[model samples]
Target: MRAAAGKYRQRNSHAIWRAHAESASHPMSEISVSATSTVDERPAKFSASDGTALTGTWFEPSPPRIATTVVVIVCGAGIPARFYHHFARYLCECGAAVLTFDYRGIGVSRQGNLRKLKSGMEDWAVLDIPAAFAEARARYPRLPLGAVAHSVGTLLLGAAPDASRIKRLIFFGPHTGYWRDYGARWRWLLYGVWHVSMPAVTKVVGYFPGKRFRLGEDLPRQVALDWAGRRRPELGRNVEEARRFRLILSRYREIRAKTLVLSITDDAFAPPAAARRVLSLYPHLVVTHETIAPATLGCGRLGHLGFLRRPASEFFWRRAAAWLITPNVGDEPKTTTQAAQSPNR
Candidate 1:
């Protein structure tokens, strides 16, 4: 799908990333404790299959012992790993190790200029996502793997070499990129932003300056183009030279994880219609499709990017984490069954 909007009071958040990066290390790094004092955070680095360097962070239970589960946060199109920190820490507190990383040419993994970075959505799906899974498996062997994919992150999940290793998955605002599927009222406006103006602007700047437009971080030229050009309901391009794209979608069948596809009522970018199209691609998985109305959660509004943000997290984050640690997906967790109960305060 497209990059989500809504920064949730973000102000120089990248500086926080830089502050942590100053003391980054291999596998492990300097630790910082969350306000809850129930999670331990550390910086970690790894490389993609193509030897392109990537950066990530690990969130573990307060005492920092190895956990029985690892939930990798597959970020959306232009958003960085930091956007999902709230969700990651919640997973950690629930006794699951969480891994959140920036895709190539994004956030901490960004190198040089993005326009020169030749990677596109396909590169992220095949090279980067697999590498992330590999890194997680190598670091935490034999533990059950899970993922929380947001927006285009859902598309990236299929081509991962370790897709079968994922025992549970949560598709947050998952959608197949079909412009017609946008919510009725805001359809044209969003289409104008993502499909029309985005490409035009990216063409001039040599990248998608998403932050300038309040649409998450800037993206590589091809990443924006890929998002813009994929107007069809399908996963990838439909013409010739797309054999590789077809090959990537073919791997969708490999993912047999129990999944929960969350379609936010207020998420015009990813209505249930659009999210269902993504679900259609994964026929082999045991899946549950849930449409969450803001009123039902008493949050007033939870947009495409709001699930992991405040207000919503205060009311819903823990319940979502509860699903990841459930025995239905993996082995027993160190935390109590209360972890799976309703997250309402």
Candidate 2:
């Protein structure tokens, strides 16, 4: 596993993404996922519903045959989809095609101008995520579909179209992200960062340089502003705020797919309360919530982003794979909820 990851790091890192503009495609770029050559990872491109070209990496399952199911991975805020390469490859090895793409204004998906990017979480949901699902459905019409999201990715999923096509919805560190959702120890810090510092800094620089703070990539001004002002359902103030809110609420209510919401006990950004708040949005779904302790996985910590790292893949990735490949939700006992935790509480 270490050798495979090393090869991915040396060959297909995000630095390679810098070579091509978002509108350009790397037609034949390929990377062998492991020393045994079990999976083939290739750079691919697709367009969002708005005619915006997005960039992604497609991990093909072994045997080079058509896949019966495809897993689309949507990343957290600031973090690019390339960060989930190993996880995607793992899913591919488990007999599923996986496509991990950057949301607009992020990594390889950031086209022509960086400073003038007008995308936000709503664009990802209504445009990017839905486009990915459409692309996958178009490419493999009869295949079962699955989506795995992290952090804000889950909220984006709640707003995306074609929820009926997705058989399973897997959420990692899902949260509504209101300041009140945070624990006492981190509430003030989150409030200051999201509500105060981010807006103030973005206002001066015209963008938030998240890379400097090791948060992820630098984000567009509007993206940061939207995140900062995400405290209320009214969206505080904006022309499209009401419409975006309605779209998200409507999408969540429309979903009937089975869901698995995973939360790390030690995750400061998405504790049980925070994750459950987002789970509450899908009132008509069969949502199975699991809170895992780091020690149980033999890891020192499993924070909001830790589960995606290679070392912890065995703990969560297998379960994700089973959820994706299963014929039905009941085929796996893990899909059943023993005592369903209500988000209302």
Candidate 3:
């Protein structure tokens, strides 16, 4: 009986899932890492909900051991998954399989012409997420699944139909992007970026020229329009749009995974308040929340996108791996104060 218990414990310890999301609003350069060093990464292909062939890279653990968990890194709008190669390889080094992919009309998922792309925000949230989940499950059957999302990526998970399949979730700088969530410090800048800058650029190029601005990859016209429209408080106040919003919010109940929400103190794109608001939508889930000041981590001014890169990787990334593997950290529901007590540490 003791031996059996020991075996069970060994299996259970590694058999957990983690999903991570970061708020999307910054530039991400291509991640440079040794391709054959710690992980065996290769280009992979999977089908989207509409049967569109989506391209991705899979990072499998070296030495070829059975993986107990799989990590799916979801990108924010206009940001390709290639920028997350380092993060994926890091997770692979931690003894788990990792997959990163571009959503439709972004990065490699864009097949021929960009001008004719008809995808929108809803397609990304509802369809692309489920497809990614399906691919991960197919590759690693019975293993606990995890996800990491950036910016709009987290919102997409909240809107996914297969969200319940994930056992663990971690979101970095997750926000719904409603204009009112930001404070005066960033309101004008955000307004100019969303309403003025993006509109002018999209009008000229027929899509958001995010690449030229170093905001990541260029975006489809409808995707850009959808993001711009989200700036309004009511999201157009129309009956159909209002109903759609209700539907998306209602899907949060399906996400029963234990979640950790990380917010940076100085993130102008998705501040603490915005993170808190996004968490409120998932009232049914047991979520642990943490607000980190970059100074505390010695990673000076992490802002919105710095956490994914180096410096913070020393402390923050390890903590994330720990939380993903350990289910007891946030097993019980706690208040915001209780959740902030360095449980991940």
C-alpha local distance difference test of each model: 0.73, 0.71, 0.71
**What TM-score, computed on C-alpha atoms, does each candidate reach?**
0.83, 0.83, 0.84
- What is the full ranking by lDDT, best candidate first? 1, 2, 3
Candidate 2 minimal-lDDT segment of 10 residues: 1-10
Candidate 1 local lDDT, 176-277, one digit each (tens): 566887888898998999899999999999999888878899999988888888676555466663666667666776777777667788898887767756
Tens digit of per-residue lDDT, candidate 3, span 1-345 = 000100000000121222222224533322333455667888979897788788899999777554558988888777788877777777777767888999889998887777788888888888888888889999998789988888878777888887878888888888766766665598788978886788778878898988888777888888888887766544344788888878776677667777777778788878776765566566555666677776666544777776675555445566677767655755653423322110110
lDDT string, candidate 2, 1-345, tens digits = 000100000011111111111112532222223567677788878998779999998888667555768888989989888788877877887778888899888999887666788777778878998888887777777777888989978877878878656877788888765666666687789899888999998888878989887778888888888788866533335666665575557677677667777787788888886775666566666566667776666567667775765345555776787777766743344432333333332
Error of 3 at 250 (Å): 2.4
Residue 256 in model 2: shift from native, Å? 1.3
> What pairs collide in candidate 1?
none
Q: Please provide the root mean square deviation of candidate 1 (C-alpha atoms, Å).
A: 10.3
Provide the lDDT at 58 for model 3.
93
